[model samples]
Target: MAGIGFELRKYLNDDSFTGTLKAYGFAGLISAGPWVLSIVGVMLIGIVALTQPVVGEADGSGVRQFTTSVTWLMGASLVLTGLLQLVFTRFVADRLYEMQDTIVNANLFGAMALTTAVSAAIGLILALTLFSQSFAYEFLMLANFVTLGNIWIVVIFVAGLKRFKLILYAFALGYGATIVLSILLLPFGLSGLLAGLLIGHALLLFLMVGVVLPEYPVTLTVRFDFLQRRLIFPSLIAIGFFYNLGIWIDKILFWLNPGTSEAMIGPLRTSLIYDLPIFLAYLSIIPGMAVFLLRIETDFAEAYDGFFEAVRGNATLQEIELLGNHMVSAVREGLFQIVRVQGATILILYLLGPTIIGWLGISEQYVHLYYINLVGVGAQVLMLAVLNVLFYLDKLRDALLLTSTMLLSNASLTWLTLQLGPQYYGYGFGLSMTLTAFLGIILLSREMDNIEFKTFMRSRPAQEVAA
Candidate 1:
């Protein structure tokens, strides 16, 4: 992501207001491209379905079901891949640092293969048990799950490659194909829609794999050396899982709650009170994400590297202290920028809530939920920035602790809010994230203050550690 940031910074060489805007705008598009495109593709499918006169009222229900199925598949696949994404990223980064390129490709293939097999088995079992009435739907569902899981694995590697433009193009192509194919296949209904998605994702997986494969030395041998190696941090895996789990926990609670949720398909449920508003609110985070990548990658990262480089060069303590202060300042400014930008975005969206909802043809009754959810998602961006700082400081335990708190808090508070009724619907997610962000800010501040001492202590030789 920092690499993407660096690339984007080139666009700001002139430093004019328009240039800065262009830089960040492009950065946001590249950063949020894949998920935003997916959302658009799905929404287009729904819109097309709703417009079809021959389908009548059933079209709306079918569109809802299709949307729910696709959303569920994406959420579930993300949870599964989250367990491995960070750990694999760590492993790959370590290998690259050591110039062990051959094993990187081999291990990546091994990971994707493992994920595909597991996803396939799970998808098959679920299809068999849940969708017995329609074999075509079951097959399409299974294919989508497997393809999407593999695509995530491929995407992680591609992201590491830092070819932001190429990645953006690939996503555009894939989702473009999906939208077109889905419209063409709409007459076949949900299965056809899903088939379009599966095919599109399969193409995406191919393109990403192509981008990733050429970087490594040609090797056919599969290696699960990462699994065998103890170099991976357990906390990294925990943080990845907990963080993603935290993000979705509130939604899950709402989905399963009898008062808020209604059955969508085969034991799947949707929370009418929670889902749409939150999803729309999340789309507003693109600018914040762009700024986050820029500030962290360019400003904070350079400061971090400079501080360490100065240390390595045996610079004076005063110089090191100055560098450390610079790093801290960079981080603070970065976080503040993210908050300010996202806060403004939230405000803008809040003010336009009615207009947007009216345009979408959704009830104005959802406006309150949308406003609250916007705040929650903004806090989530802040929390993520804090966690990124922790990662830079090698505070995996702190990151894990914060994410765990977020998960537990979201789940418990959401359940409580459900019991409290509809007026409190979005407060659980908003309050939980706000609380976690507050804690994260405090922890991050303390960690930055003592970062030098901690880094020195951790870097001492093993024999010196005995002393």
Candidate 2:
């Protein structure tokens, strides 16, 4: 998102209220637009289903099944491709840095092909063996799963480029088609909805590829040289895996726990008590994410580059430390801003949450859970910002440890909450994130204080070798 952030920050040049609004609005849309479309679009489809069920069923069984299938599809895709997300991003960044442009497009195709093969193989296994659904449903789902995974990889590439408007347009058109086609096909039941999804995503994938592939010349041979031993960053791989796992582990625990969840489909269980509130709470993070992408990508990135550039150049100790201090302050201020922004958003949501839940026909009983998850989501955003800063600093070990902590704490504490009963349900996720974010802040502060020493010391061996 460094590329996206750089483009968005140009709005700040105005330094007016309108400018700030533009910056945030664009950021929110760019960052979370797809999310808004998915949530709201699915809800609309559900509403349509509620009003009139198909000929066979009185209830919106099709809608429920469709939603469940999609939920699982997204979960499986993200977790399956988690390692590639960071590792490939790092590969592209390095190749770009080294001015090896020709390597990028082919490697990207290689990655997409790799992601498709893996996701398809696993998806086919699960779709065939685990699911007892009709062949059409399974085939549609397998296709959608493969497309979504490929889309995720393309997003990583296009996000690194500055094609913000094109990205938004592809998202809008593809999802727009999804909603229209899904509603039109709703009468056909689950397979139809899934078919709608497959088409929309296929188009979206094509458009996304257009944005990226046209820019770089295509190389004849597909390359998987990125998987070579020297190019791999195991710490980054672990960080991506653990972080993605950590975020989902609590939800998985809830779903698999017999006490909390019931079977939704073959091998898939869902916790009605736990799922809705957390999903809604995630929507509340758009503002924080917008702010997050801005500060981290712009201010913190600038400071980071300055400090490192100063070190690599002929800057003296005093000069380097002064820039280091700037970088430290950037980190402090950025984290604080995220907290303040997300805190306000949380408070507003708290006051209005009951009404919102009522509007959605959700039980008022889930209100407390929603509020708790709100804070958890906020803490996760803060953790994400911290992780981004850590990544920029190349503090991969710290990142890996923090992600591991989140996974362990969320899993264990969530299990404890289940034992403690309904009132404590959402506390586990909230508390885990809060604990991790606070720990991250402390670690970051300490790391910033000693970065210069470590930077110079680490370089000393290379310096000696050169001499």
Candidate 3:
């Protein structure tokens, strides 16, 4: 991500206002494109399903079912892929650091094949047992889940490389095809919608594979050495799982709670009070994400590399200290930039809340919820920046603890809010993230202060003796 940020920053080298805006604008789009596209695609499907009677009433039953399936598929696939994402990223990073490119592709294939098989088995069982829908619906749902899972695995690899443009193009094509196909097959009802999504996702997976294939030798023999490596950090697996869980835990609580949710399809449920506002609020974070990538990846990353290079080159202790301080300052500046940009963005969206909600034809009640959730997601972006720095600092324990707290707090607080009623709905998410960000800031500051001591302590015994 930092590499991509640096690459994009090159476009803004002229330093003109227009150039800066264009660079950041493009970065924001690419950074948030997949999420924004998914939301738009789902909303479009809902709109079309409402207008055309697709095996359900105009009251949005069919739309609800289609959207519900999509939501579930996304949640499930993300959870399934979460563990693999961090673990595989670590493996790939290590392999690349060692310049062993051939194994990277082979292991990726192995991981994909493993994830696909697991997703298919689980999806098939769930579709068969839980759904009781027609064979077409079941098959399409299964296919969609499997394809989405594979797409996520491919994304892990693609994101590790500098293929942001290819990724953007793939999602654009895939979602565009989905919209067109869903309309063409509208008469076929929910099954048609699912089919469209499945086909689109499959195309996306194929394109991602195409981009990644050129990076390594083609090998039929699959290996799981990365997964099997004895030295792999167990905390990484936990952090991956907990972080993804934290993000979705509140939604899950809402969906399952009787007071806030209703069944949309099969056993799946949607929270009327929580979903739309949160979704809309998330869209507001594009600016923050763009700034995050730009600052952290470009300025902070350069400082970080310089510090390490200085250390490796046997620079004077004072020089190393100065470089370290520079890196810390860069991180602080980057974080501040994120907050400033995102705060302004939140304010703008809050001011425009009514106009935007009115244009969407949603009830005015949603505006307040939208305002609250905007702050929540903004805080989430801040937390993400903190976590990125923690990772760079090799503070995996801190990252794990932060994510764990977020997961527990989000789940418990969201449940409490549900009991407290509608007025408190979005507060749970917002408050939890706000508290987590506060803690992260403090921890990050302290960690940066003692970074040199920590580095020395973590070095080899021989190096310690020499020192």
Candidate 4:
């Protein structure tokens, strides 16, 4: 992504209105397009399903079953894959840096294969034992879950390599087919819809596989090098798991709490009051994501590279320190830019909360939660930027601490809020992110302030003999 930003800078250099749009447009596509398009695609499917009415639904009165199933699939898959996603990402980075590019694709295949088996086993257990649905529904659900897990792995692989154009086209075809096949299959009932989802994502999986295949044609042999103890960072695994768990723990509590949720299917449940606002608030992060991509990748990345390069090249302390200051300034400016953009977005949403809720006809009661969660996820972008910088600097301990704090805080506070009352419904998750961001910013500031010592006095390179 940092590399791709240079190409985006080319458009911004045009310095025209159209050029500016092109730059941000490309950035947004790279940052927000996948999830945004996915959400929209699901909404489209729901709207179309509305036309014919939900057929074969157990309740026959609500449309929660299909959506709930989809939700569970997404939530479970993300958390499950979270363990390896960051670890694998780091492996790829190290391999690329070492110019061992041949093994990258083979390792991805290995990872995908492992992910598929794990997700399938989990899905089968849930489908067979816990969830009581028809055989077709269960099978399709399990298949979708496995396919979606593979998709996440491939997506991270491609997106990390900064294949922006391929990402755009791939998502376009994939989701386009999904929507079309879903609509076409809608008439066949929920089973048909599930089949559509399965086929569409399967198409997407194949497309992504095809895209990366040529890049590493050395061997597709199943290699578990990533799992080797020496190369794997347990802290990274913990960080990934904790970060994703923190994000979803609030919603999970909401869905499972006896008072807040109602059983939907088998043990699965839904929190009508808590679900809408947060998902919608995620869409609001587009502007902040765009800004994050542009600033962190372009401005901050250049400064970061310069500082490191100066260090390795034996530059004067003054020159190295100057570049360090530039890097610090870049991170500060980037974070401040996100705050400005996302802040403005939140303010606008807060003001129009009522109007938007009224427009959606979901009840004006959601307006409060909407406003709170907007700020919450807004803070998420800020926290994520901080984490990215820490990861780049190899401050894994600090990164793990922050993410662990996030998980603990969000889980405890959200549960506490639930116990308090509906009035405090969204306060917990929102506040947790704000608190994490606040702490992360402080940590980053301290690191930047100590840049000189960290570079010169801290741990020396492995091959260097300390004085």
The lDDT of each candidate is 0.83, 0.82, 0.84, 0.85
Q: Cα RMSD to native, each candidate?
A: 2.8, 2.9, 2.8, 2.7
> TM-scores across all candidates?
0.94, 0.93, 0.94, 0.95
Q: Candidate 2, after superposition: displacement of residue 327 in Å?
A: 1.7
Tell me model 2's lDDT, rounded to 2 decimals.
0.82
Candidate 4 lDDT tens digits, 1-467: 44586678898999999998888888888788887888887777777776675553444433566777788878888889889898898888877777788888889989999999999988888777788878888889889999989988888788776686687678778888988998888777888888888888898889988888887656858788899887787988999899989999999999999998888867889887888888999999888988988998678978988998898898999998889889999999999999998999899988988888888777676678988999999999999999989887888889999999999999999999999998899999999999999999988888888697787767745412111
Question: What TM-score number comes out for model 3?
Answer: 0.94
How high a TM-score does candidate 1 get?
0.94
Model 3 lowest lDDT segment of ten = 458-467
- 282-394: candidate 3 lDDT, tens digit per residue: 99989998888788866787888888888779899899889888998999999999999999999999999999888977778657778889999999999999998888776
Off by over 4 Å in 1: 1-7, 53-59, 459-467
lDDT of 2 at 200: 85
* Candidate 3 segments whose C-alpha is farther than 4 A from its true place: 1-7, 229-231, 460-467
- What is the alpha-carbon lDDT for the whole of candidate 4? 0.85
What would the TM-score be for candidate 4 when compared with the true structure? Answer: 0.95
